[model samples]
Target: MSTAMSAAWPYPLLADMVLAVHFGVVLFVIGGLVLVFVGNRLATWPWVNALWFRMAHLVAIGVVAAQSWLGMVCPLTTLEAWLREQAGEASHDQSFVAYWLQRLMFFTAPEWVFAVAYTAFGLLVVLAWWRYPPRVARSRG
Candidate 1:
């Protein structure tokens, strides 16, 4: 790598940004279901019933579950790991935020345990879809 490229890349900061994005995705997958159910009951938050939002939420969880069941690591996780390595930093020992986020998302359990958990969570999201279906957009008269 050229010295200019090495100096301009900012791999460590990029890796940290990826970690933060991964954390936000995790939050959305978990919290989105809660909001869907609550919003359905309240009838005050119609945006939660938006088809686009629901589809995105479903797809996000679906990808996670599919990756887990297929025994494949997430691309985001792989990218972050690669970035950290490029920056000459340990995967889980980088900074305080990264360390805690790793601790929260990763566990020492067997692979099958994670597969089962992800499948079950995916099923719950499916159930939520049936329970509170997304609203179809109305055509203008």
Candidate 2:
């Protein structure tokens, strides 16, 4: 791939629409946690892999958060926008992060809201990490 293409590569897109669906999943998992905290029965289903799923969700969110803070564009975001363009849909040309994330994710949080939310989300991931730590031992075996 050329530099332009490489800059927007979709390791994330190819890896689970990682730019989009993962965001959706993270939101869902977090929302589910809130429900569980509120004593929702759905949060207590026997077949639900809540702990493992939330751990994965939180980790993915952490990676995305780190990338944003470091000023690195997400490959998945690039690829998805490219795919949308190919499909004749609109894409963000250029703008502040606040504008696009708000439009794409339907989030209207203020700048401080985003900062606080990210910090809280990061804390959640840390807590989950303490509880789970990713099960690498089992996976390697």
Misplaced by over 4 Å in model 1 are 1-9, 139-141
- For model 2, what is the C-alpha lDDT against the true structure? 0.53
Give the deviation of candidate 2 from the true structure as CA RMSD: 8.6
How badly does each model clash, as a count of residue pairs?
Answer: 0, 0
Q: Rate the local accuracy (lDDT) of all candidates.
A: 0.87, 0.53
lDDT of 2 by residue, 1-141 (tens): 787557545432343343446466556656744543343345454323355655566766677677656666566566665654543434444334423543656455555566567667777756645643434224355
Top of the candidates by TM-score:
1
Cα-based TM-score, every candidate: 0.88, 0.47
Q: What lDDT, from 0 to 1, does candidate 1 have?
A: 0.87
Give the Cα-based TM-score of candidate 2 against the true structure.
0.47
Worst 10 residues of 1 by lDDT: 86-95
Q: Which stretches of candidate 2 lie over 4 Å from their true place?
A: 1-23, 39-51, 92-116, 125-141
